[model samples]
Target: MTDVPSSDIAFTPRVKALQAQRGSRSAYARMEERGGFRTAVTPELAAFLAEVDTAFLATANAKGQPYAQHRGGPAGFIRVVDEHTLGFADFSGNRQYVTTGNLQENERAFLFLIDYAHRRRVKLWGRARVVQDPDLVARLMPEGYEARPEQAILFTVEAWDINCPQHIPRKVDAAAAAAALARLEAERDRLAEENAALRARLGER
Candidate 1:
């Protein structure tokens, strides 16, 4: 067997110079000098987020490694309990418990809600905590629905920012929101037909 040659890779002179220009110390100093940063969510953003049924929940571990999961519920699932408070249900999942585990380590989290049909997006940053009180869950549960076995996670909003839809591409068919469900039905039909054909061939054998 031939031996592979070893190679050394290093930053170019220009890259090294650029890196030195903004070291971690300088970056941290600049951030510290900013005092506090806050952005209010516009009325339009609040309305859009209220209308959407899904959002992407992003959380990070103590080391700042981020994980994102898609969360969905009925329309108006996300509730703006107050001007600075937002809450949503935490349904069951694969049980990886990444978000819940991360929140235990680091309460800071972020959420992004996008209405593809409406061409809008909202970003929310806040501190989150996993709440596990039966009475509280009972109060929050929708009428006629049982409480999920998994506990819910609540997020207390610290700041939120609204992005304009000017940059979002226009949607061609807003009514096609049910296309995915239709595709699933079609796939089920196709599988059934294939199964029936296989059964017929087996009988012929």
Candidate 2:
């Protein structure tokens, strides 16, 4: 029996078999030899999380029933607590609590983060826990955001990998696009005034 590589937390024997069948195992094997997915947050990953205002969190119950929940707030809402941990304030929503219930039964979780404007995505596998401490929740909460914090969820990352930007359609944030349009309008007005002055000067000449 071939021992599993320590850095390869994502690929199981079944997954490897499929890769081999598809003729892609050798490339992955080379990757494994270098070192598989990253287990700790690097500088690049930390910067990416800073601009991520949205994420999808996936969890499963003890019975293996899976659920994915959408989480969103201002940029930097998902804060990196440390090299191995991530945290965010759990805002009150519809009170369904499906994610909370699943976590109680199963700690294993996955975080999917995508930056539409940049056409980049990241996948992280981790274990998560919910904290009801008011102090911790307050610390993670974003100021000036109109949302009531119900609690906090802390995730300890096990392994993570970034995917290529292929097939990711580029999109811009609504607020950012609006700001850019405003700047262009202002510049157009200024140029219109300059053109009128130049016309008057030519007439005088």
Candidate 3:
């Protein structure tokens, strides 16, 4: 959680204006017609999506200020439905809902998927819509799992691109995944204990 100064990291007006002008054209020719940028997703992109368990989602506000949030789930959280479509399960968070709020104002978003275990990364760009259809959510959920009614957001991906792995280092560990899960459970238990103590002290007042 490092705070990035709004001034230092802000997008230039030219870039912001270009994004606004691009709007929502899908085809490269149509995007070119509107002076928008375009990129193609490759097989490498699909492989990275399958391996990565977390991603950083970036969006902007009405004033063109950008925000980035790290989102995580079990491996395969982001599913590639096809060459152009991607799906993911969005769960409850700190409740600020900044990403959702930004999407409402501007559907444009960028997703960064990094597979640290393999030191690989990919970038996905698209428009997202929050969906609440039970059937759709159910279909997206892994086998033997049910969607939590209150904590799901469906992202309809429009375009994506894969980056070259030249900068990424190679590394892998079989135990790393299990160790991470155990650490999370331990932290949750510690937090619950502290919360109970705080509640007990309040009752004594």
- Pairs that collide, model 1: none
TM-score of each: 0.60, 0.95, 0.58
User: How far is 203's C-alpha from truth in model 1 (Å)?
Assistant: 56
Q: List the residue pairs that clash in candidate 3.
A: none
What is the descending lDDT order? 2, 1, 3
Q: Return whichever of 2 and 3 wins on TM-score.
A: 2
How many residue pairs clash in each candidate at the backbone level? Answer: 0, 0, 0
- Best candidate, lDDT-wise? 2
Badly placed stretches (over 4 Å) of model 3 are 1-43, 144-159, 166-174, 177-205
Q: Model 3: number of clashes?
A: 0
lDDT of 3 by residue, 62-146 (tens): 8898999997666777777665667766666577989888988988887888776666776666767677766766666655434
Clashing pairs in 2: none
Q: Write model 2 residue lDDT over 1-205, tens digit each, in one string.
A: 1255534677888999999999999998987876677888899999999999999999999999999999999998999899999999999999999999999999999999999999999999999999999999999999999999999999999989999999999999999999999999999999999999999999999
73: Cα error in model 3, Å: 1.2
Instruction: Evaluate all candidate structures by whole-model CA lDDT and list the values in order.
Output: 0.69, 0.93, 0.66
Task: Show the lowest summed lDDT stretch of 10 residues, model 3.
Answer: 1-10
lDDT of 1 by residue, 116-154 (tens): 677877777778888887665555454554436367667
RMSD of each: 15.5, 2.1, 16.1
Q: In model 1, which regions exceed 4 Å deviation?
A: 1-46, 143-149, 166-205
